[model samples]
Target: MQNAITELEELTLNGASRSFLKETAKWCKFLSIMGFIFTGLMLVGSFFIGALYENLPQTQAMPFNVGGMMTGFYLVCGLIYIFPIYYLYQFSVKMKKALISKDNDVLAKAFEMLKSHYKFIGVFTIIILSIYILAAVVGIIGLVASS
Candidate 1:
């Protein structure tokens, strides 16, 4: 009877461990999705900003003020940037747990994706900042030339 009880306890413990692992995997998947979404949205926003600038009438474009757009864009981008960092932190925790459980495959996949995500954000920032600086320089030159 005692042997049977021990076996049952072991089974129960194993079940609980599996449940924990399942939850961790779900979180990993969620983080991956969020990373992809953030990257996509940033690219889309860049396109929208470009289109808006191109569509504006040149006559009124000289005194363009993006105070409102700049405020909102910065707020959204700030949140987007913070999210990946938070995800990478969470992934490190999850990967540690996975490694202890001998789930090295999952750890490898998650960290690989996390690394790619980090690079994606870096590229997005470089492109966006370049465009923003170029626009400002051109605008300043135009203002000075007109004066």
Candidate 2:
């Protein structure tokens, strides 16, 4: 029992900073899980959209069937867009919890910064990926039109 108390003290006492890291770790695990689900849905949607585009006629935009499918698909994609946004909110909530608990202010601030940095990079990557996919689609269309 003494050892347990000692360990808990060491865990919380190493610095308020360490506790903040723990909080970030806890929240990031959840955000990462959401990211996984969103990415999977996007991958599946991309395949279906690709197939639909393949069947499209020249001079015709996507048909009602394809557009309808994509409309539903993008709604889920938008949810994916917000999945990481939830991480920002999670960071805010955890920071507040740390403040209310009178824990480490420095570490709490660091945790917020860390999550924001990750979120920024992730959003950038998503944008780049979207552009690449667009380019690929255009390339495929050019090839089909030429052939």
Candidate 3:
């Protein structure tokens, strides 16, 4: 393990690797910017959801405030989306700076941000998959009970 760590520490980026990293940083910046814009749009759209749902006849018949619930849902989703996007944005900016200046600390920080971004996404994916599985099980149980 120590040998592996030493080897990793000694590893250096070649010109090709640096070029690829620079290109990746550029793409990350573009994607992060797009994500931020969409998240902002989603948050803005959340406000309109209440108004839209208020006009629906089905929602009107419901005892609960469907509009408010939907707006809150959208807002929560938008807020949840911001973290990974911000991490990605930070990774991109830091990576570009690190590459340009050949700063090891900055590069490490940039990679840390990238790791955080992926980790957040991975955990989120697992949670979503778990919810899907739970929903499927509940649906099957409901169908069986009805029959």
Native-referenced Cα lDDT, model 3 = 0.96
Count of clashes in candidate 3: 0
Q: What TM-score would each prediction reach against the true structure?
A: 0.43, 0.39, 0.93
Query: Which runs in model 3 stand beyond 4 Å of their true positions?
Result: 1-5
Give the distance in Å from residue 124's predicted Cα in candidate 2 to where it truly belongs. Answer: 6.1
Candidate 2 per-residue lDDT, tens place, 44-85, comes to 676677577657775755445664576567666655565565
Q: List candidate 1 stretches off by more than 4 Å.
A: 1-71
Off by over 4 Å in 2: 1-64, 105-127, 130-147
Positional deviation of residue 62's Cα in model 1 after best superposition, in angstroms: 14
Per residue, candidate 3 scores C-alpha lDDT tens digits across 1-147 of: 577778877869999999999999999999999999999999999999988987887823677898899999999999999999999999999999999999999999999999999999999999999999999999999999999
Considering every candidate listed, which one attains the maximal lDDT?
3
Number of the top TM-score candidate: 3
Check candidate 3 and list the clashing pairs: none
TM-score order of candidates, best first? Answer: 3, 1, 2
| Residue-by-residue lDDT tens digits, candidate 1, 54-120 | 6666665455456446546755775667666565655656665665675656666656756766786
